[model samples]
Target: MDEQLHILTGSYALNALEGDERASFEQHALASEQTREEVRGLSAAAAMLAYGVEPVRPPQRVKDNVMAAIRNTRQVPAEAVVTDGAAGAAQRGHDGGVRPGAGADLRLGTGEGSGPEHGSAAGAGAGTDELGARRGRRSAGSGGSGRARPGGSRPGAVRALAAAAGVLLLAGAGLTGWALGQSTENNRLEQELAQAEQTQGAMLGILTSEDAKVATARMADGAVVSVAYAPSLNQGAVTAHGLPELPAGKTYELWLQHDDVMVPAGLMSGASAGSPMMALLEGQLSGATAVGITVEPAGGSPAPTTEPIMVQEL
Candidate 1:
């Protein structure tokens, strides 16, 4: 029982055992009448402490503000009554209040006598009554309901507008992100295309140089094959070591084959004796498929009379 009392004290301080320990404590509290009484006492003490520590201060102009609010509320109904003197008198009688007469009492600036000030007050009160009556009529037309229209906005309208604005802001951000991604991808593709164009131009320059030499061959039979030639346009030049030599009266004629038609490449003179030759082939080898050496007559043939002796796939 003493331990249970201690637990209740700790709970009051918000420092008791937690989780399973608190759950067990609660179960024990429910089972024992004494523990429940202790817990209740501790709870009451805690509440007293909480309330004591809370700050309490009167609102500024609270009296005037409250009075003003009450006055405003009553003004509507009071003005309605003043609109009809007979009705006003009847209402006063129902409330057991004395009705003021036009010549009841005389006081300076107090609408009691038949003076100008009294007349002025009467006129002003009558105006207030007429205004209130109009407001009462309007209220009655609206079914005497004090609540605003279902869809009508109040102070919470600002919050709704803010929420709508936030959604639009999020949508705008998403569109901006997508647009940036597409722009980056387009830039990357443009760079690749430019690089490809540059590479093509470099290849074209290499295929059309004049200081190019070519190896040539001809068939034993005189063939009317003309040879047009260009040098082998390697970065530096290809070392032709271990190449085979040409036979006598049958010079090697180089020919570039394009799309099933053989274009003439220049002739090769002298016996290479199986040694590599330092020669470049001529003409545009941009899109050539194969290079062929055919045998031709002395001084070279206009075309090939016989088949090629050697051919290299380019």
Candidate 2:
């Protein structure tokens, strides 16, 4: 039930946690309903945020090149197998005193040299058979080792190429995600900047108006609420300092009062107990004679549900 774990809900919802940190948080979340609910809320928010961004598609050329390489690459052949019969034949040829190169002539002389009184035909036939067997075995064994076959190591090369292609694909995907995230962040910052500019403009109008009137009320705790109202522009800006923090599920809500009727204004930014904050009051201020502050539900109520903590006549 460590309170510090609550801060990780954002990162967890974003799937940014890794290894033991991820496991530990998940375990803690299962045991704590508050943490679990927070994680769910944050996750839903993250999902909505993702849906807000436009989708990005990778270029077709990257896919085309990877597929083309896979299709064009050749498969490596299995190594040849040598049999016991071929070994025996080679042994016999060596024992018969037949020179390796001279065994070639035995095939050509077999038919002419055959005769009933001579055994030359039998001798020539045996020599030719043994020589051919030896040649076949030699070719089989050297198919994987000798210079005549240059593709012996192609299997390793093909595997390496495929691995490289996989790495390239992953890198490209990562870069795409990074670019998309950055774009979303930039858009958010731009919107925030535009809003801040608008707020500044409104505040300046109220403070610089020729008919502007400023009012203030001080609380028992020494906190102060101030409002600047401009009759010419029908707008007012509320500023507060040293406002005490309320209990959970409660917030400070502002109101514009016209006679006995109160209109809902904006809520405070929930700053710390003794912090300063300023916000332009919502709605027109022409008929409103005063501004009031009250403690209400977390989100402000449509009508004031509590007594005014402070009221300043404008």
Candidate 3:
């Protein structure tokens, strides 16, 4: 936990942390005034460096319209351009997107097969031709159509569209991340819940079984090892009380003896003088007639490397 606290300083200034992580960092920061001030100063510096953009003066009213559009705003009826059947049909077609020949005049740069982008002057001429064709059609048709000329959208409208696109992209990324996090959390909780249910059911079966047998042994440290075994279920519940906490990278492990061989049963750690720990030995005692507990390295040894501190005969 202390190591995790030390690592939070790197991300504290970015405002990028998710829930629980942010709260934990905040608590650590509050506890250490120096840490709090350091984070604050770093946050201010990061803000400036990340946003040291040069000033850009966009067209008048671009800010207002772009913000309003991003907020899903509505303007007065008088300000809206009315659209009837033909205009609506055009909108639906655009909404449906890129019908083969109706897409944008996209030009590829060099390296495209059999082609490179034309010079700026040629490109300008092409734009002019496209715009002129659009104007000619609008003039020839009924005035009820609200279609604008090619590239004729207002500067404010263009800004609004760009802002909308950016908002949508960010929103999509956020939703995808949230969904992945939810899936991971759900899987973790399900595993924990299943383990808890399994342990509880195994304990209940041992306690209620009519053919259950119990044995106990006294350790050199004065701790007691107890085992409740059920022959019918081939399972046992083991408990140790008054265990002394071992040094770092050391733990206690249990084993079940089948004839001359002793197989791993489970591992126990962290229990102290007053606290007790329980473990379930499912099917480990199926063909075994006795159990043993021994000291081993952390994560438990593959097989016991020392004599048993406690042993119980069935």
Candidate topping TM-score: 2
**Residue 230 of model 2, lDDT score:** 53
TM-score of each: 0.24, 0.39, 0.38
| lDDT (Cα, tens digit) per residue for candidate 2, span 1-314 | 66776678787656576534543453344345466556534543454454577898879997887665444332222120001111122334445543332222112111344322111111111111122221122223323333222222322122211211111111111111112232244544434333332333344333323344666667898876667765544556677667776788998899989889999988865223544656667765667878888899998999999999888887
In candidate 3, the residue pairs with backbone N, CA or C atoms under 3 Å apart (3 or more residues apart, or in different chains) clash, namely: none
Model 2, residue pairs in steric clash: none
lDDT value, residue 202 of candidate 1: 19
- Candidate 2 Cα lDDT to native: 0.47
- Candidate 3 deviant stretches above 4 angstroms: 1-194, 270-274
Query: Considering lDDT, where higher is better, how would the candidates rank from best to worst?
Result: 2, 3, 1
Clashes in predicted model 1: 33
lDDT of 1 by residue, 35-54 (tens): 54443334333334434566
| Residue 64, candidate 2: alpha-carbon lDDT | 82
lDDT of each: 0.35, 0.47, 0.45
Which model, 1 or 3, shows the larger TM-score? 3
